[model samples]
Target: MQQADIHAAAQTLLSRRLNNRMTGPLKAECRPNSVSDGLAIQHRLLELMTQQGNPVGGWKCALPIAVDGLTDVPVVAPIFSDSIYTTSPCPIIADEGWCKIEPEIAFCFAQDLPHRPTPYTEQEIVAALSGAHLALEFILSRYLQPDSVSFIEHLADCLFNQGLFIGPEISLEQAFQASTIELTLTTASTPEVQHFAGKHPCAEPLLPLFWLVNFLRQQGIDIKAGQQVITSSYAGVIEIAPGDYFTLSYEDLGEISLAFTQD
Candidate 1:
């Protein structure tokens, strides 16, 4: 398909908050020759973003395969100007014509992701962490359609990544070494707090750093110097509605509270 065809298709679907249909021939129409080609289109879209003057500020990472509790996918998205927020008690827009709050784990990088190969050693990832935060990622999907959507599609669209509220920063050393930590997510309506509930597979929650870095490297996109990388949520991506309050605690890591509103 022509770039305009794809662009128009994306615009129509996004405008209606719909998912693209990937049917027999339609699938062939939307399909890029290869994953790298798909990424090229995404980059071109980012380049055209300059004409709009709101450059992508950074990036947010997601575990597309992590949904079923034990899977992994290599995809990340640009953190647009409108999506970056100061981590504090804040508001988030939601679907269902409203807004809701969500608490997440976020990481910041100290240096650029080196141009290299996959299976980046744990040491390389550890050395890159500049900061960590108890964050709130506003999880909004384009729509609730599965056939037309896939993990890779979300990655290309910044993973439907709308906005993020970040909290105070701390050294990765502190976040990584902490063991038996508790994470709580709460809202005004619920007495319960969402918890991390399990130990991070590695010593650090920043493990996804290496995974994402390697993913990008394979795609030929350099994680330039001074760019921050927000790792995927180890917990699940829960749905939210408007009028919700949320909080997350990481014991020594820190605590974050957020309120929500609708667009």
Candidate 2:
């Protein structure tokens, strides 16, 4: 199919979300032929989605988990303002009653790295960061069958992001202190108190931030002030099941709790 046809199809697919979307339609529809085309479609999808009033609040990035055993570029996508929440006593459905909780560190920018003639360096980008916070990302799949989808399909779908839950802000310096942080995940409903001696997979959390600055520049997108960017997952995807209540402690840094209910 042509690029326009592909874009329109992708938009429709994204708009419909999981409703009326079947797994069998994967091989036969809306596949972009190249990365550029796919990314273009993704931009349009974001535009269309945001036009509905859910403005872009921030972004979430994750290193692609080698689709089908083949290496793929990292995926970055806008996080809508409506879905982002400061963790509280509020209720969250987690979209379809299930959500993948990825404990991560998110950087909030204090200065805008606007579209510039010269690229923003790692040092400049670092200086612009306002603070860091402990976050739990909620994964939302655009396709009915995520595994049956292709690489570009995954890309255009924004790497299965639904939303993010960020806790109280902390100093950037304080965030760095937990470089080799120990994490404990405990749920009252289960006997499991899983402990992880976690370290940023990239050695330092800011490494991804540095990469993201350049990546956005390459894509001709500006990094806005006050916009938060979550680096990547420290503890892969942890699904929240019914009656599940979790307390994730990050060594000496801090901790956050999540309570999940079927209601």
Cα lDDT, all candidates: 0.58, 0.72
Q: Which regions of candidate 2 fall more than 4 Å away from where they truly are?
A: 1-3, 17-29, 62-72, 89-98, 261-263
In model 1, where do residues sit more than 4 Å from their true spots? 1-28, 31-34, 62-73, 87-91, 97-102, 112-128, 144-148, 178-181, 190-204, 224-226, 239-241
Root-mean-square deviation of Cα positions for candidate 2 versus the true structure, in angstroms: 2.9
Across 123-227, the per-residue lDDT of candidate 1 in tens digits comes to 876676667766656666554563465555554455666677777776666656653456666777878765666344344556556666777677666665545
CA RMSD, predictions in order: 5.1, 2.9
Residue 168, model 2: lDDT of 64
**What's the lDDT of the predicted structure labeled candidate 2?**
0.72
Instruction: Locate the minimum summed-lDDT window of 10 residues in model 1.
Output: 17-26
